[model samples]
Target: MHMVELKGVSKAFGDVDAVSNVDLTIREGEFVTLLGPSGSGKTTLLNLIAGMATPSAGRIEIRGRDVTHSSASERDLGMVFQNYALMPHMSVFENIAFPLRVRRLSRQEIERKVNDVLDLVQLPQIKDRKPRELSGGQQQRVALARCIVYNPALILLDEPLGALDKKLREYMQLEIRRVHAELGITMLNVTHDQDEALTMSDRIVLMNQGRIEQQDTPEQLYFRPKSVFAADFIGTANLVECEVSAVNGDRVRVTGAAGAFEVTEVEADVAVGDRVTSVIRPENVEVRAAGDDRESTGSDNPWIEAVVKDSLIVGGVVRHYLTIAGDVPVVAQQANSRSRLLLSHGDRVSLRWAQNDCRIIAC
Candidate 1:
């Protein structure tokens, strides 16, 4: 069942449309992330669902109840913001207990709830410490504990880990994922970090210019983007300009910098002679030996001779920047294995990939 639905939702500020004709559904236990750059309308959409801002158009439904006109407090949703929003004067226990107290819960019940949440977030020992006394990661966990203590059916997290250091941010990503899995509540998160979205979300809604460009699972969005914007936004991709040629069977021929290569892959409605963009992920490209035969390669193979320009080894992954035909630079990533070939600058290599690896967009 969809716990939340946004029907034709739109928000306007003066003459500008912040969220335009957006329709989305969140299932009862799904974690969906609104991912985009700042001013791309991700935050605005989250606000609409939270009832912090009224939509200029469309309806919002939470648990089959109309919430378009409801106030934030009436929505029964937990919201965590970029700022921890912790009271400087309050202890961790007090902060976690505040939400329940506002609802007028009994003193015994509030104590039990706060204790359970503190344990759930792994901060049971610091319940007596003030916010200033806690580390950044611990403070963020306290904020999360406070939000979930009341067991709200819906949770909205807006860059909740934005202020943490890099290592802490990565650790908190796993913590957030663990919480989402354990609670099984509908969660809608807004974040500009692509890696965070990919790491935590079941599905990602990529927004651009106040409109939804694409919404799909992480694998779908990364491997089969519907547009050039979607391709470039989700991950590192090499957008090569190409032209469509003959449509043979299930594939289409695309011409690019190297030469006319036969590729039988597409994700959009396009025809022959159309000017299209080919999206090839860096990790998809394979580096082959110089004497490799074209026939030995698959029929969908697009092979070109290139020279290794630079290399970087980060986190046990080999990142190779290859210059095809001496000028056009392309990138390929390979796993770090016990036996790996080292390609240095000016080393001649063959860049080969199966035709099905190419994804066509636009035109």
Candidate 2:
């Protein structure tokens, strides 16, 4: 049975619909992320699931029990917010034991659970310190420990790491994943950060304008997006407007500002004369000197002539921005290596990628 299920769930405020007819199922032990831009209904959906807000329509079930109208306190869920939400006057021990105390667990049980969770979060020694005395990361860990100490069936995190710096945020992502792996609890996380969603989620539900655009595993959503929004939102993609010129078996030829290109594994129902957009990731594109012999490349990859507009070495990879067919912009990312062709502004280069690396979505 699924840990959480939503059937046609929606929420509206006055005349604005925050979430609309959304259906989702999260299995036990799965880490699912609701990811999108602000006002895209991701957070609102999370709120509905947490019972902080009532849905205007539809039903919600937690472990097969309908809890659509249940109050937040009655739902038995653990939640972590953007702010630590710790009581400033309370010590870490008190904060972590709050839920257990609320349930009227014996003092001994509360102490045992609190100590275990603090150790699990690797901050057992700081139990006597108040929230104000701890670092931001430590405070966040205390909040997480408090959530897990109660042994709730579901945990909801709303931008829980939003307050941390980039480096600390990245560290917390790994830390959260470790905790989830150890506990095997169902987690529903809300965030507008795509990188965090990709790094932590077993599955991601990409939402937009009050509805789910796509839900799939990280690799599937990144490599096989079904819509333009999905392609653009998940990562950096070069979406070129084109028209289908011909179709040969699984390959389709498209003509656009970048010139003629062939795409394989056409999943969308596209045919000749149909307008489409070619979605290709920057890393999938390969760059070479324009003067290199085409035949010598020894591949059927379709090549486009472009002039290097800019280049930046980002750590271990070089990002090359180019102009194709005048105003059309394209980017290629290549590993920084000895044999990589170096290109500068105004340098002419040939860009090519495997036919399978590109996908088409009907415009």
Which candidate's lDDT is highest? 2
RMSD of each: 1.8, 1.3
Candidate 1: residue 314 lDDT (0-100): 71
After superposing candidate 1, which stretches have Cα over 4 Å from the reference? 289-295, 298-302
What are the per-residue Cα lDDT tens digits for candidate 2 across 93-187?
A: 99998888889999888888898999999998989999999999999999999999989999999999999999999999999999999999899
TM-score of model 2 relative to the true fold? 0.97
lDDT digits (tens) for residues 1-363 of candidate 1: 579999999999999999999999999999999999889998899999999999999999998999999999888899988899999999999999998998999999999999998888998899999999999999999999999999999999999989999899999999999999998877899999999999999999999989999999998998889999989999998778889877777788887786677666687767888999888888888887566554433465656888988878878788899887527778988897766568788888888666878788874
Candidate 2: regions farther than 4 A off? 294-299
Best TM-score among the predictions, by candidate number? 2
Q: Whole-model lDDT, candidate 1?
A: 0.88
Instruction: Note the Cα lDDT for every prediction shown.
Output: 0.88, 0.92
What residue pairs clash in candidate 1, if any at all? Answer: 251-264, 300-355
lDDT of 2 at 184: 98
